[model samples]
Every structure is written in C-alpha cells, then in structure tokens.
Target: MKSKKKTLNDFGGIMYSTDPSFVYEDKNSSPVEALANNQQDLRVMLDKKNRGGKAVTLVTGFIGTDDELDKLGKMLKTKCGVGGAAKDGEIMIQGDFRDKVLLLLQKEGYKVKKSGG
Candidate 1:
C-alpha cells in the first residue's frame, strides 16, 4: 500500500495532519499561471511612494512562481549593483535605473514597457 504524502508550510511545520479522520481544505487562492519569459508583459515604473522620496524601480506583471520572481529580482539587483526585494508578483530595485532595466529586460526577451511619469 502507498502512503499519503504530507505538505509542509513555512517554518518547518506540517500543514496538514495525517490522522485517519483528519480532513484538509486549502484556504488560499489558486496559484498564478506560470508564464513564459517571452510572454510576460512586464511594466517597469519609477515609484517613490511611501519611501521618503527615494526612488525604486518597480517591475510588475510577472506571472510566475515566487522562486522565479526572486531569481529575476536578484538578477536585476546584481545588474544594477544595488539592493532591493521581490514579492507579490513585483520586483523592486533600489534605484532609478529605468533605462538600464528596460534594456536588460529587452536583452532577456521579455516584453517590457515603461509606465508612469
């Protein structure tokens, strides 16, 4: 007989119990569809909101897993030689590198556009 598999959440905790009478129901929304690199229409914008007037390059419209998002964010941060974060389908780079970012995304074959004034 094959045993059922267990899913682990963050913090090394088991998300569901393996008890015979236990029932597991997922409460979160479905995951976003994984999009191909070339199909992603990413928007690059300059945002200084809620940052004390410090500008950040915000890349949104990424439809992929969190890992992929983080990887891309890391790449952008490295290429821009700065520090930032990636989360909620967006990559935030700590600077005003709109032109550089646009060029980099173009080289990577992603459909990128510059938004916001």
Candidate 2:
C-alpha cells in the first residue's frame, strides 16, 4: 500500500506559501533507502492507547519504502493470522503478538527486540 499523503491543512508551512503552484513535498517523496536485513533495528510492543483497551502489536523503526513496509506487515499478519496495517513508518498488528512478531522478524534476518511490559 502507498503511504498516506498530507493535505494542505496538515502543514504549517503550506499556509504561508503565496505561490499558487507551490507544492510541498509529500513525506514519501524520496526513494526509500534499503537497509540490510541484519542492520534493521525494530521495536515490537503492545499498545492500547487511543483504542479503548484493545491491544495492538506495534513494530516501529522501519527504514524503507512503503512497499517494503507493506510487504513486511503482510508477512507478519499472515504468519500470525491476524489483521493489521502499516502507516507512518510503523506496523500495527491487531493483538498482543510481540513474541511471535519478534520471531518472525528474526527469521526474516532483522534485529528485533521486545519493548514495554
């Protein structure tokens, strides 16, 4: 999936621009650099804030393209047999699956760590 694009309302700088044709860069404008699988330092944790009491396993600190992030999120969701999404450079898997996600990431050759209690 493609990264979410910011609207004019989301940028403070955009408000001050007088040029009608001026275009602020989308966050994903740059070509994402590919990090070596071994060099990836990913944090896996369960979060409940903003979602009532439900837990969502969040995997953050990914340095890659939206395509790469989506691929990884898809792999994790498939492995865990759950639903989730990837956005803003973070992957949110629905449920507390840190341990399982950690293993999946490790098997994929990424350096994974469990965070939070």
Candidate 3:
C-alpha cells in the first residue's frame, strides 16, 4: 500500500503549505522598492455612521501603536475643532472631515487613502 502525500496547494494557499522547510522570497531586489511597499501599506478608511443622532466619520488605519493613534487623534480633534474619540484602535471624529483628516495624516508622514464619498 502506498501512502498519499498532500502538497501545499492541495489544501489551500501559500500560507497553508505542507512543506515545513518552505521559505518565501520576494522578487523585489531593491531596498527602495521595499520601503515604498511599506509606505503604501499605511492606508486610512473613512466611514460615516449615525451615532447619537449625529453623523460620525470613522478613520481606521495602521498607525504603529495605541499611543501613536491616541496622539494623532488628539491632535486632529484639536485642529479640526470637533469632538472625537479613539476607541477600539480607531479614530472617530464628528461630522465629515475626510479632506481635513487626509491633510493631517499626510503632514504626519503617513500615506493615507481616503475611501467613501
């Protein structure tokens, strides 16, 4: 009797490879390209939702850590002169401040993407 060996692709994608010694390598050879890739990863999504009968715009993104997020949120709220809160690792500001938020994020050296109309 022969035993059947399951391959990585047979089960799922690259993350579920059966090979224990598998190592993934990127074809991007330049360090500058890698940095650009990292920069592109920083994105912000703006969403408007009703909270307490008011429309609140939620800005979500990867901004290092909680401390950084808190600092940024505080700065943004102050500059925008609006009420907001940083909860659940996201920034929630009152009203539609997409353009203002985008400018603030750019000034802080983050590549932000504004989504939603």
- Most lDDT-accurate candidate: 2
RMSD values for the candidates in order, in angstroms, are: 8.5, 4.5, 10.8
User: Model 2, 20-113: lDDT tens per residue?
Assistant: 8987765745677889999989999999999999999999999988889999999999999999999888999999899999998999999999
lDDT of each: 0.87, 0.89, 0.65
Worst 10 residues of 1 by lDDT: 1-10
Tens-digit lDDT track of model 1 for 34-69: 888899999999999999999999999888888889
| Lowest lDDT 10-residue stretch of candidate 2 | 1-10
Candidate 2: segments with Cα more than 4 A from true spot: 1-30
lDDT of 2 at 77: 97
TM-score of each: 0.77, 0.77, 0.57
**Candidates 2 and 3 compared by lDDT, better number:** 2
Q: Cα lDDT for residue 53, model 2?
A: 96
Clash count list over all predictions: 0, 0, 0
Clashing pairs in 1: none
